[model samples]
Target: MSDRQAYSGMAVTGIDAKGRAAIPAFLRAALDRNGAESRVIIAESANAPCLIGFDPAYLEANRAKYGSRADARLDAGETVDANAARLAFALNDIASYDSSGRFVLPPFPAMKAGLDKTGPVLFAGLGDTFEIWNPELLEADAKVHPAFKERALFCLSQWKKGGKG
Candidate 1:
């Protein structure tokens, strides 16, 4: 297998009343450049209040490992596809952006998470998955768990210091 790739920085966004959020133009451009704009997966995270997004490439890897082998007999192996599918479909909703560069989140969960309208959200890029966070929730999480800031800052500083290539 090939080595995993590193993802870029977190993009900050603002949610509108209509549950529409505008992703960063640079990110959109990057996705376009990488040919990943049209296919992406969005789902709720296991440990955070944030919603997570995954590129199709990443999802396929996941499928190959855990989602693609369900048809085998139970004696042979178990498939996590059903649960993964439920989690992805129920908690995480996949979306595609229109030409205008807007994605409308489902209103129920957005409202439940206080992402209802006019809130800042953080979009963090993970290799195969990206996470969305309400800015305040992120801030609160940082406050409660100082390691996040410590680790993030340490990593950021490493990049700044040319410690990372």
Candidate 2:
């Protein structure tokens, strides 16, 4: 149950009208391997137009790393906006899933990621964290990997056909 366990793989699931979606079994296994609780932290990705999900342990590690960097900057006589740092880290929202891996998406973060109430949500694993994407948005993103875009397109087709995706 090391916190170093990595997340890998992709899954597509639907978000109901209540914004509830299931975490794919593969990603859930990775979280379990890391000794994570049923809760996960969801946040908007700074580098992409998607939401990122990770365990609390990883969130703490990120906070510690950012704190160290800010301290270093302060020690170097550089100006650091304490307020901005807090706000930046405050973007994360905690979500608790049931044993079946179903959880309600936080509205703000979901909306920020362009996720609608009902549609296919693609969960793509990225080692330390996973990305939650709106399949259509992902398919239209030119900066996304070709393979990912392809997968998104496939998911979109399945969703349109009334499949689980």
Tens-digit lDDT track for model 2 on 4-47? Answer: 77888777888989999999888998777776789888989888
RMSD of 2: 2.2
User: Pick by TM-score: which candidate is best?
Assistant: 2
| TM per candidate | 0.67, 0.89
Q: Candidate 1: list runs displaced more than 4 Å.
A: 1-6, 37-39, 68-81, 88-90, 142-165
The per-candidate count of clashes, in order, stands at 1, 0
lDDT of 1 by residue, 6-54 (tens): 4556556667777887655555555555456564566667777777765
| Model 1 lowest lDDT segment of ten | 156-165
lDDT of each: 0.60, 0.85
